[model samples]
Target: MVLEGVYKVRSIDEVVELLEKYRENAKIIAGGTDIVIALRNEKITPKVLIDISSIDELKSIKDEGEFIKIGAGVTFTKIVESSLFQKNLWGLYKACRLVGSPQIRNKGTIGGNIANGSSAADSIPPLICLGSTITLASKNGKRKVLLEEYYKDKANYGMKEDELLVSIDFKKPTENRVLSFAKLGLRKALAISRISIATFLELDKKGQVTTIRVASGSLGKYPMRELEVEEFLCGKKLNERTIDEAIKVVQQSMDERLKGRSTLPYKRVAVESMLRESIGDGIKFLDGVRA
Candidate 1:
């Protein structure tokens, strides 16, 4: 059985003070989705839970000069419903949609998702694909880290004990860019992804791939960008043959990294399928057609 701890804090300052004073014994709880599950499973037992859900400063979505800054405390549902996100960040909106049930999405925060650092986390795959970065804050100050480099270990994120994820920065996609998020789960909604893929490609006026990024989750120890595949796809035409080759390269690279894992075959197939679909959709988007 799980033992519940006394939950405290209603503001960002309160949270920072708690973390500063009890960094070793306190844990931050945003949505409580991941932590509740862990508590139920006896995976973690904290003496104090600092709830940051009511932090007003950390609950907003704003447009910066070059990027859209999404407050870490914003919910998945908020992300999906935001007009700014729908108009400017279709991939991220779609990733938020893929999270879980409506209630789960309403409760889950991007900070919690990134802080958990699970390879299967829905938004992480797409964020990595978009070259996203996360800002972490503490009583001392703050620092920014690329989402791709945030995963410090297999079981946990690289965040320091006193730091809290404050926001995510989404750089404006280049003109004629195509971005997409896809995932394979056993059941439709509320299921953990067996494999997930995110694709972002920028095409020039002549239809050549100018820039491309591909990221996959649940295919390795950490959600990662398939840079080899991206490099191969650059300057290539978005054709069946080229797409197949790119998928093959990704599969081969994943195979080398995931040698003895039991889910290799399934993940390989899913990755290929998702990549092809993403590429096709991205190409259509670049061509100014519906995908």
Candidate 2:
């Protein structure tokens, strides 16, 4: 695909100005891992391209008081290397580490992954489990939307034509909380996720689950929390029995949602092991933390 013009933006204001002027005709490029492929396949034909990879304002990961803010331009490799994520957000770190290959991870921006709006996108399930929100800015103003709500339609995310996603923010998980991720792909290296799960679990002093959030990707139109499974896990001990029941709940939910789909049989069976591994990892991590 050919673009009419490519503008390297220096700041968010410049990006907004170009977006406002070009509207639907302009597309923002950061890392270009996703956009470049779309452009080559003629899936996206934009008259102008605004490159934001050089904007320093959108590249830093900062630790705010109650939450951590990840700049939209931050790459997956940066996420993997960040001590903050490595030390606390293991689920997100693991998901980032598993995204594509080294070169792809080095160049793929988290914002681009979210904006691409693929249900199979690796980072989204973990983000949803974390209760993340994204900030979209325009010449008009900025608006924040929950990550789960960003996808208003099957093929379209709710971002306005003039808006540029600037950052993703989520509250920091406390010591009692543990997050874990598991994915099934065709092959180990550079694999596109077929089915994946991310789980956020918190345990009380008695080793019973106090809070739980379970999210899956490549299983629906968009990544979503398995609320029924979450409800079943609450107040339950993270033992083999609870794990089995949780897996059953998730399988039942998937069966209801994907009854007639060809992939249902495989997915329903695969999801059980995925959830089991993710929940088991969370339990192990919590045990290690307490020890």
Each model's TM-score, in the order given?
0.93, 0.96
- Per residue, candidate 2 scores C-alpha lDDT tens digits across 15-122 of 999999999899999999889988999998999999999999999999997999999999999999999886448999999999989999999999998988888899
Report RMSD (Å) for each prediction in the order shown. Answer: 2.4, 1.7
Worst window of 10 by summed lDDT in candidate 2: 148-157
Highest-TM-score candidate? 2
Measured by C-alpha RMSD in angstroms, how accurate is candidate 1? 2.4
- Tens-digit lDDT string for candidate 1 (1-291): 223565556666677788888776778889999998887776777767888888888889997867888889999999898886563257678888888899999999998988887888888887888788888888988788888888745235478888888999978775566678777888897887778888888877767888888888788777888889989989987788998899899999989998998888888888888888767767766677422
Clash pairs (backbone) in predicted model 2: none
Best by lDDT: 2
